[model samples]
Target: MVTAAIGLEFVKQFLNLNNPPEFVFACCRDPATATDLKEIVKSNSSVIIVELDVTKQESVEKAKSHVASIVGTKGLNLLINNSGLINSQRIGDVTREDMLKCYEVNAIGPLMVAQAFLPLLRQAAGQQSSEPMSCSKAAIINISSGVASITENSSGGMYPSRASKAALNMITSNLSLDLKTDGILCTAINPGWVKTEMGGPNALITTEESVEGIMSVLEKLKGEEDSGRFYHGVKGQTIPW
Candidate 1:
C-alpha cells in the first residue's frame, strides 16, 4: 500500500512493468483528494483506490478488510509500508508531541497495518509453489531511511525522524524473524535522498531514480538470506543499521 508523492510514482512504475500485478491498491489518507492517483489509474482497471490512514487503526483495519474482500482466497503478494512523516524539529527544538506524532506515523502505523494484513500475506505464501521466499509469493517492505542507522549518524539532526525510523528498522528486523517460518520476507529499504517533498529539491536523486533502484533491489530479494536487512535504494547495497 502507499500514499501520494513517491508512493504514487511506485504505483505508476508497477503499472508500467512488462507483466504487472493483477491488482495495484493505491492507498492514501483521502482518496477523494487523491486526484493525481485517480488520474494515473483512470484508464486502468487493475488499479484500485483504497482509502487508508496509516496513523489510524480503524482506517488500517478497514482498508485491510476491503483488500481482503477483493483478493479473496488468492491473497495479497506484497505489502509496502511506504507511508512516512518527517518533522523539521531538531534536538533542542523537538517536543514530546512531535516525537509521538512522528513515531505514530512512521513506525507504529506500518506495524498496525502489517498485523492487520498478515493473514492475507500468509495465505499468499501458502498458495504459491515457490520454495524460496520472494516478493511474488509474500513480503513486507518497510520504507525506512539511512538516518535510522546509528553508525551512519554523522550529521545529528531530525531527532523525531531519526528515532522513529530507527524504531521502524527494529520492527522490520523483528518481523523478518517472526515471519520467516511462514515463508515471508521482510526488509527495510532506504530510498536514498530522493527529490520528493520530504527529500527536498536539493536531494541527490529523483523519485524515478529512487524507485527504479528500489525495484531492482526488491526483484533480487530471495529467501531467508535477503530478509531482515536494511538496503540503500539507489545503490542496492546493505545499509549500516
Candidate 2:
C-alpha cells in the first residue's frame, strides 16, 4: 500500500520496473486528478491505482476496507507512507493555512495510513517467508525529510516543512516500538535532495537513484533493532533524528 503514491518518483520508478512485489498499489489523493503516471500505468498491469485522501479519517477507513477486500487474509507485505506536502520559506510563500496543511499531510497523514493498514501487515507476519521475522520482515517506510533535523538545521527556515517532518520522525520511532511485537519493521527514510517537483531541478540526485538505494536498505531490514532509525536512502547512511 503506497499512500499518496502516484506523483512520487519512487512510485513512478517502482511501477515502471518489474520489481519484487507482484502487485503494487498506486494510491493518490484523487485518481482522476492525477495527471502524471498515465504512461506508467498504461503499460504496467501490476500497478493498481487506488483513491486515497490521507487527511480524512473516513477516506482512510474506506481505503483500508477496499485494500482488505483485495488482499483478503493473505495480507499486504509493505506499506509506504509516501504522501507529503511542503510549504516553502520564501517570501510570501508561507501562511497560517499552509503551516497547518503541512502538519495535516506530512505528519498526521502517515500515522493515519499506518493505523488504518496495520491489520494487513499483521497478516503478512503470519505467513512464511525466507527470513520470517529476520531482516526481510514486513515493513513500513515513511518518506521523511532532512530539514526535520533540528541539530543540523543550520540553514533554519521553512518551519512548516521542517517541524512537520520532525514530528513525522517521532511518529516513526513510536510506530517502530508500537509495531515491534507484530514483526513490522517501521522506519523513516529521507530520500535526500532528489530532483523532483518538490526537490527542484538543482537537487543532487534523481528519484530512481533514491528509490534504488532505499530498496537496497529495505531488502535487508533486520527486525526490531532496525526499526526507528532515520536513513538517507540515496546516501545509504543513517541520519540523526
- Best TM-score among the predictions, by candidate number: 1
For model 2, residues 1-241, the per-residue Cα lDDT tens digits are: 6643323565666555554456677788777867665566787776777888989999899888888888798788888888878776744667788789999999998899899889888888768454444423477888898898777888767879998999999999998888777888888888788787777889888777878888777766775667889988877788887
For candidate 2, list the clashing residue pairs, or say none.
Answer: none
Best candidate, lDDT: 1
Minimum summed lDDT over a 10-residue window in model 1 is located at 1-10
lDDT of 2: 0.78
Residues 80-176, candidate 1: write the lDDT tens digits: 9998888878888999999999999999999999999999999999997557999999999999998899999998989999999999999999999
RMSDs, each prediction? 0.9, 2.7
lDDT against the true structure, per candidate, is 0.93, 0.78
In candidate 1, the residue pairs with backbone N, CA or C atoms under 3 Å apart (3 or more residues apart, or in different chains) clash, namely: none
Off by over 4 Å in 2: 3-8, 12-19, 90-95, 129-136
Cα distance off (Å), candidate 2, residue 23: 1.1
